[model samples]
Target: MKQYEYKFSFLPEAINDCEKVSDLETTCEVKGKYPCPCCCYNTFPVPKEDAIAYICPVCFWENDVFTSSDDEPSDENRGMTLNEGRRNYKILGACSQDMLIHVREPKSDEFPK
Candidate 1:
């Protein structure tokens, strides 16, 4: 699993050497913002390293630090794997069928180009 520090800063100077993404596919380097693993939307406030869990507002997948692999089931996520969450998001518009009511559609600016 990858580790990331949570930071909150709008100033460009706040970005430092620690905020570097080695893999765009699975990590976010930007300060105070992180890509939701389930939705791929840059909306998470806390990075994967910070234990304060965040559920994506768009897809409703709870951020769990350990389950970075798409195939691995996460206890923190109610035993749902990243792949299952992604598939559920496509079909139900949320990370799980039951989460449809808990999630909202991504804003126009939230989708990755």
Candidate 2:
């Protein structure tokens, strides 16, 4: 059985460090002002060290944006403090065995006719 490893990032900076790929193998790219996953729409690479929270690009428009309190700007007029909302967005990824094996007996030569 072959095992595969998975890696994820939510920022452009982190994806930039990865070896440039042909947009085929799980990789990253820039789309407009946001970072996009080269392989899938639900996945994008983000800088693990970045302070700002990351949201999935595919769902960003539909979902409320999230930001960490530490990264939020200090302001008084802002209806709700940056810290008021959720700090981090959920990110999902997985890795597992990529191969399967099966055993079976050969078909019999007997004919129905």
Candidate 3:
């Protein structure tokens, strides 16, 4: 029963393909503009995904950012609209900031657990 969740994101000074990480172990990886993970102050990665309704007037909390094949975007990570035109649905954050590596959960469950 290990479930520690913290949502609030950013980290995109320049994203082409998309993929950023920071769980903070030793520190030093957060490129350009910082302070986001609920740090309050916002807006860094913007090229406009065509008004996706980003509502978060400091923790009103209604933005998923992106990257969710499955892991709960909460509200069950919703669905529909794949962003076929591109921009792949914003949010390139958290690829691995802490906990280094290890994932087996329900996908089959058998690895070094």
How high is the CA lDDT of each candidate model? 0.76, 0.28, 0.29
* Position 51, candidate 1: lDDT: 37
Q: Which candidate order results from sorting by TM-score in descending order?
A: 1, 2, 3
Deviation in Å, model 2, residue 79 alpha carbon = 9.0
Question: What would the TM-scores of all predictions be?
Answer: 0.64, 0.17, 0.16
Q: What does candidate 2's lDDT look like per residue over 2-92, in tens digits?
A: 9999655765553456676675576443332323211123233343223143433332311113434433542321333323222212121
Candidate 2 — worst ten consecutive residues by lDDT sum?
94-103
lDDT of 3: 0.29
TM-score for candidate 2, residues paired by index: 0.17
- Give the higher-lDDT candidate: 1 or 2: 1
lDDT of 1 by residue, 1-113 (tens): 99999776865664466655566466532332667888888777666567357778888888788766879888878999989999888888899888888777776667776
State which candidate has the highest lDDT: 1
Please report the candidate that would top TM-score against the real structure: 1
Q: Write the per-residue lDDT of candidate 3 for residues 1-113, one digit (tens) a residue.
A: 99999655675465589556666544432121221222123331332232143432222222344634333333411332223111222232212222113211111221112
Off by over 4 Å in 1: 1-32
- Give stretches of model 3 more than 4 Å off: 1-22, 26-40, 47-60, 64-113
Q: How accurate is candidate 2 locally (lDDT)?
A: 0.28
- Note each model's CA RMSD in angstroms: 15.7, 23.9, 22.1
